[model samples]
Target: MMFMMFSPYSFLFFSTYMLFMFSLFNITNFYYYWSVMELMMLLFMGLSYTLFVSSYSQLMVYFLIQTLSSFMLLVFYIYNLPSLLTMAFLMKLSMFPFFMWYINLIYKFPNFMLWLASTLHKLPPMLMIKLFSLELNTNILWLSIVLTVLFSGVMMLMVLDLRLLLVLSSIGNNSWFLLSQMVNMFVFLFFLVIYSFSLFFLLNSFKGMSKPSLVSSMSSNPYALTLWVLSISGMPPFPVFFGKMLVILSLLMTVDMNYFFMLFLVMNSLMVMGYLQSVMKYFIYIYSSNIHYMLKY
Candidate 1:
């Protein structure tokens, strides 16, 4: 009876979730990891369009890009081409030059897909990075991280939309993902967990908003909004703070990470600025709107 009530989309969502979990067990197996991620992307595209009919074309293009990347990834891995393999994963993760689709499509994601894409979908390629010990040019890596951080910060300053802020913040966090892996797989996993936990609450809060829109204003729960800001900015008292500390410590212990360390501090300041902008706008909204109610009647 319960199965009978399950929509096709729900079933597919569960299947994708199971496949994601199953892939974790086979995380070290290139073939299994590749196959599972390929399958997951296929399911993800289908469900995304099914649920968000208006964004079908965008979803299809994103699908094709990922499919092509997956195939190229296979060929590169087989040839022991670490450079190509690393590039393939970067494209798959939609970092920098390849990020146009991610920015266009993330706004259209149903909240579940948003969380899945932001957190889980990103994991396998990162896992593969560790599995194969692939490395990119240090200059290229530094440049990419710097660009993502700078872009997200600048964009965040202008956006009032909650979902857009979440997207930009996650884009910036991809730098952390890339850097954490350089530290070690364990630190990488720790960072991912901290990120996922913080993002989940942010998403859940937005999900609770009614049909007109997911407003980030104090019109909703203002207290929750403050927590959301802290979560994104990684202020003290949140595990995000500690996760970043450990990454910084690990990077310091590694040679030649001084530049990255300096860049990391700049990135953190930008994150705080961006998220604080979000919360402050809400306070501004409340004060301006509420200061005159019924005009002393």
Candidate 2:
């Protein structure tokens, strides 16, 4: 593979340059858009190397490149490009539905790389709020929010893997919550930190278990996974809960309460019940005589 032939640093440099060229050539007319595209492209290219390249020495370079590119993009948005800024903003945010690339990357990359992806890529959406005038169209914002929430919720429900579910649910809830604008900004940040930390811990904790245990824990046990899923789904007390609370608060303030509230409650409750049933089945497995057979090699 080309990845194995070149040193990570060399490969990263080459990739970055290539991406720069692609963006430059494509956006000849739209110079501002081209620049933003190139910057994001560079960050994405760097992310690929950071994840795939085996060399630890290249880590700092990769991070530095990503950070600098991101900073430049942010400054450009804040200053020069107000018209297509929101599009650039959405691209940067990597929010749900608009997030297929990110989710695919997460699935392909190792867990540790999630740190860089989550931290660096999360800024664009947050910064978008600052660029918007108070009079910006609420309908488009709400539509995006609703779609993100529903799609994420359904995807989480369907996904057999907890990590994937968590990823989807987090994106969904956070996108909707951000749209609501009811919660203080600090609360959203705090929730994100806590949720991310918890996911890291949960994933690491199950590392010692056998393959079957891991699979069953993810697939068969409703009771065992209940807390984990609920926490991720923003049920209550968990950090995501605050995000959902803010979203709900926003909906109450702006939209028709009856329909939105019903939709929110019903969807969330279904997710909760789905995880609950799975957890309950897992616990029931503990008491079954076939448990030994299930655990046996």
Candidate 3:
């Protein structure tokens, strides 16, 4: 009865999400985790149907891609084929080379599906990395991160869509995730939680609206929205900074390719600030006009 305060759809979605997360943490058997995740994906597909019938095709594409990733997982389980597990997880998350399909599918997704796919659907693979990421070659991970940020920067320059921009922003934040993953085991989990909260806070502000939602929310809660942007961007004094700071310190301990890591740090910083600048442009223009209009009237 208490949960009935929200619409049934809202209640169901929230409940399913919480359950999925709970199971993700508690489950140890690989097959069990895989089965639970597949079930959650099916539930999300059904839930999306209630509100966004038109997104059926995109969701199916997502499901099929995920199934392919799982087949990779099956091989990894059976034969342990050369980081196939890692590749499967990254492919599922649409990181780096696999981002092409996500780019194509993301635009067609309705707002709700976009939110779930970007934020919630990404957790399982992240959990897998936490359990087994240390064995990865550090140089390769950093190189991929650099490439991801570099590619996202070029695309960020040409995109005007808020959803697309946010998706690209995740490309940068995920670099931090991998850094923290390798730097310290618990730190990865910490950054993941903070990053997810910031993203959820940012996207939830959309409140199920179209492209102008950021401006609309800014007009009402400019300070809150602005701070969320800075936090997500890892601006100093925000919570994300501590996690990143730890990673930077740990990175300094690695002597090989120190210059390369420095380049990555600089490029990644610029990539994040690029989005921050765009957001600030909106805030300054919109917030200033709102203030000026109020003062004049």
> What TM-score would every model get versus the actual structure?
0.86, 0.58, 0.80
Best by lDDT: 1
Off by over 4 Å in 3: 1-10, 107-115, 132-140, 207-219, 250-260, 283-297
Question: In model 2, what lDDT does residue 83 have?
Answer: 33
What are the per-residue Cα lDDT tens digits for candidate 2 across 1-297?
224434567467656654554444244334454355446645555555644534444445544544554554566655765434443444445553356655654543444344335533453335335324323334445455566667666766676655565456556654553544434555555555665665554443443211112345443434434566556655678766776676566656666765544665665564555455445554666567367777884
Measured with C-alpha atoms, the lDDT of residue 242 in candidate 2 is 73
Candidate 3, 60-97: lDDT as tens digits: 78778988987787677667654665566567777777
Q: Which pairs of residues clash in candidate 2, taking residues 3 or more apart in a chain or in different chains?
A: 221-278, 221-279, 222-278, 222-279, 222-280, 223-279, 223-280
Give the range of the ten consecutive residues with the poorest summed lDDT in model 3: 209-218
Model 3 score (lDDT): 0.67
What tens digits encode model 1's per-residue C-alpha lDDT throughout 1-297?
Answer: 222323687667757766676556556767887887777777777656555635467777778888988998999888877667667776888876567678787776766667668887788777777776665556666677777787877888888876787888878888889889888879998999888877767766663311113553323677876786787688887788899889888988984756765876786587778888878887777666677654644
Better of 2 and 3 by TM-score: 3
Ranking by TM-score: 1, 3, 2
Over 4 Å off in model 1, which ranges? Answer: 1-8, 209-213, 216-219, 292-297
Question: Which has the better lDDT: candidate 1, or candidate 3?
Answer: 1
The CA lDDT of each predicted structure is 0.73, 0.51, 0.67
